[model samples]
Target: MSYNDRFIRACRGERTDRVPVWYMRQAGRYDPEYRKIKEKYSLLDICRNPELAAEVTMMPVRKLGVDAAILYSDIMNPVMSLGVKFDIVPNVGPVVEEPIRTKRDIERLRPIDVEGDLPHILETIRILDRELDVPLITFAGAPFTIASYLIEGRPSRRYLRTKSLMYGEPELWQLLMDKLGDMVVTYARAHVAAGGKAFQLFDSWVGALSPRDFERCVLPVIRRIFDELADLDIPKIYFPGVSSGELLPSLKGIKADVIGLDWRVPIREGRRRLGGGYAVQGNLDPAVLTGPMAVIEEQAADIIDQGLEQPGFVFNLGHGLFPEASLDKIAALTEFIHRYSARQLQNGAAAKEAERA
Candidate 1:
């Protein structure tokens, strides 16, 4: 309505009228308007123009009535400041011009100068901060996921090249992770300073690693990113991406206020694995939206039911929404989450009052 801080309240583990719902990649190819814009401007092109980028972001908040607005920028947007060359190919994803293969390549990464090199990104945040009623979630890719592209040159089915570098050149991998971690902290801090209300560190590919490797090789940098930003008053989120169920236990003591769960694990089980002390977001399979509206509500009902069992929960997809994802379904699902969860909350309160009586 006026200003929805429901998402922020849930993240801080505070009381909310209902569970807030916002999907990853909520503002993308899924909408026809965005598709038209995509034909004219590349994802990077839109991001480089703050006005256009802010519009792309707010489209979802207006259309679907989402609880928050994630910035319409890619994780690799900051890497250009670090002097990496990559392109978000039409269907291929991030393709590195020169994959970081040696100590030389890793060392070659300069520190990010966000205001100097990425003025447009900050401008986009400033625009959204003034425009939107919802909190603006600005994000960066976590080290391992960015390194997966930097090392592998492109997305790999097995991430063999990424692991080979991690296993064979442990010191080199650590160096790369350190540099990337620094990039994320700088980039994220700049966003918050530039008027971003909250932040999310997307470690999308980190789920590919075993829990042992995640702890030994990746978790330190992940922990450091949050620790560096611990002073910020706004909510911080770490989404360990799809298939990250096994890596949950290894993520103990991460300073994030919210931990995102992919759909592979149930919400309660994912929370159980986290061992407490953070609000939980997501685990809805985005593919479920392709089915009938009745089917969609049935599935969303299960996630909301499990979510309402706990104090801090936000309704979201386990992963980003795909191009084929229906706008109508998403809008309807948003309405369903708000209405259904409100009634559930009211009923629960009534039951508790009855017990007291």
Candidate 2:
């Protein structure tokens, strides 16, 4: 139960020997081993295979020396059970076979049968729990993000169709959100029961909405999901990617255990705006990992220094890892975070002792 409590402690807003570091997409093509696997199997193929998925999930923890392991599966995986046909088109991202629009479309959506429909994913979590020394973070796409894909049918620069559904047909929007919310909760709870140490709900495209729109259309469903999961002892992380600083005020109503910040927001300022209560994760620019070691160290150190001021903080990139990012640089960054955080904590302890004397 106490395998790697450092990440868990940080999630609980407790001090640790060193700051825990884990990249968002740590098990992707950046790792040569994963690249080899990709050569043989497609992304979705690998995710469907519990044995392979478990192997990929553990690869990053073993290679990069991260403090935690996130389940290596796509957020769209759960939607397949909802009867929404989709494809993880190689370079284009998720492509829905039939985009949802009308009230009938929402009615057609089915509830996810986690154990019966997604047994492989649950088995993958079980394998990771039995093998990994660090905490395992299971994840699901938040209702809004999943809705964007469902409505737009693919990745979008402007979620025009998604917003149309929300603004034009609020009733249909609520119906869709209600269905997706239930699916997310069901999928996430099954993951926890199987052996996940924590849960992360990725609202990756939520920034596309204005604060008013988010408060009106998105907040309630997200609140419902977290409120449903509040009974679980594991920390629930909410990541609303990019341009989310303006929406932080509305996020206050969300009941997540940890609020993850994208690189656009400074950790210190995010803490101030978020009211400094719940644990926070991330805000590091992932591009910094490819820069010179000197620059990387300088930038990472700045984030670490500011993040240490928070009651609970976990070190992570603001976004997922880039395929072109250097593994050597990531390894160095991990080592530096541990060394730097350890020194900082030690100095704080010494200063406190000296003051006491």
Candidate 3:
């Protein structure tokens, strides 16, 4: 069976027949089938079982006709391999058994040996590689985002404890980042070697810091992760979450292929802000999917128009899909993206041909 490469091509600043569309967290909650699976197993349980994980990962692709499939593993999966105990508690996020703070906690962290610690995840990627024609995107949390989880134990609105550590113990903060960064590099390599076509570094909470703080406290480690993995030759996407539009200038030096945008920034404006060299993904408001169908169609088309004004654009939501997002809406939007972009590309080619004739 043939698969799609439009998403991969777009990520590399290459032209394609149409924009590729896939949502973050596309495989979970919204789908009734996934909810049935959830009744049988917890989120981490799915991650631990390669077959189950692959099944969940492919659900959105088969059902929604998304152009790509992200590995159905949590960002905290690698952290657990590093010896941190945590649970994906219902109604809450990752709740670390003991938060990391001092030098001893950092020292206690072990280097991830992917084969030994995460064979299940690698096997899942291998399954996806054989089963998927579209790109199999594997991702891990960015150092700063994972660091927040490690320091705070759970999700927080302000990330107060994380910021305090950055301000109060700069050296210790570097130590933690170094460990997590190295782990991300190794984990990413493993995923690629196992046949992942792309990788996304999800710094979902990194926007919590000010520009100065992000540069000082966070940027270096992320830079290292991308640099170390550059030779892999896969598209590397940096998802810095909301407020990342403001942080783009600071991140210009990082070696990543695409900068994901949240809905707060217009895609065209984000393209200009990123200095025009890299491709971009997203900036759609996911909430719109819950409203009227006509409104969703209008907004999705507008995003596509803005995205195509430049080269290397991928159509996606600014963030992950919410639990309540309509599956029907997702399918309709995807079909529209493929059809509309193809028509646009075809018409452009015909016009150029007429000029030559």
Pick the TM-score winner: 1
Angstrom error of the Cα, residue 257, model 3: value is 1.0
Model 3: lDDT equals: 0.91
Off by over 4 Å in 1: none
Q: Residue 168 error for model 1, in Å?
A: 0.4
Which pairs clash in the backbone of model 2?
A: none
What tens digits encode model 2's per-residue C-alpha lDDT throughout 77-185? 9998989889898779999999988888889998898888789999999999899899999999999999999999999999999999898989889999999999999
List lDDT for all candidates, in order.
0.93, 0.90, 0.91
lDDT of 1: 0.93
User: C-alpha displacement of 351 in model 1, angstroms?
Assistant: 0.5
Kindly give the number of clashing pairs for every candidate.
0, 0, 0
lDDT tens digits by residue: candidate 1, 1-357: 488899999999987888899999999888999999998999999999999999999999999999999999999889999999999999999999999899999898999999999999999999999999999999999999999998999988899999999999999999999999999999989999999999999999898999999999999999999999999999999999998999999888999999999999999998999999989999789999889999999999999999988888999999999899999989999999999999999999999999999
Question: Rank by TM-score, descending?
Answer: 1, 2, 3
Alpha carbon lDDT of residue 50, candidate 1?
93
Worst 10 residues of 1 by lDDT: 1-10
lDDT per residue (tens digit) for residues 122-225 in model 3: 99999999999789999999999999999999998999889998999998999999999999999999999999999999999888888999888899898888
Q: Which residue pairs in candidate 1 collide?
A: none
